[model samples]
Target: MREVMGECLPDVVRARQKKAFGGVQGEWLRKYHKRAVYGLLRSASFKKREYWNHLALMRKADAFFAGEGENSFFLWQCINLELWFRKFID
Candidate 1:
């Protein structure tokens, strides 16, 4: 736990931010890149998922499309979706 780690090793909590450690892949993807990735996330088929919030997801992908993000991990989701469709739905 972060709280426990911080209590045991205070230095780590204050340590300068380091890359390659870890974070949400989706957040990273939305922040870093857009164009090629948007083909799937914004695809009409992807939006057909009844459980997902389509507009909100589109806004995030649109940010990348418009070149707002600095880096990204969202592409993986797109890739995974495509592969899953090919395997199970296609």
Candidate 2:
């Protein structure tokens, strides 16, 4: 995960420089990451999808946190999860 994020950091930095950090660019990035995380979670050869379940639970926790108070944290979690999925899946 660190390696993938490291590789993607350049592009993310570029996007920030271009002020393309939101709207469509942001949406696309989010989707890409979500897919990558999902793929990673699904990659284990084990019978139980533990990683996938853990990720899902984390997402739910993020949602709950957002609802309770930490809106930014929730959004960050969501974006992180999506990015994770995108990086791993593709």
Per-prediction TM-score, please? 0.44, 0.24
Q: Write one digit per residue (lDDT tens) for candidate 1, span 27-55.
A: 65555544546766667777777656777
Model 1, residue 27: what's the lDDT?
60
Range of the 10 consecutive residues with the lowest summed lDDT in candidate 2: 41-50
Q: After superposition, how far is residue 46 of candidate 1 from its true place, in Å?
A: 0.9
Lowest summed-lDDT stretch of 10 residues in model 1?
70-79
Task: Please identify model 2 stretches exceeding 4 Å from their true place.
Answer: 1-70
> Which regions in candidate 1 have their CA more than 4 angstroms from the true location?
1-36
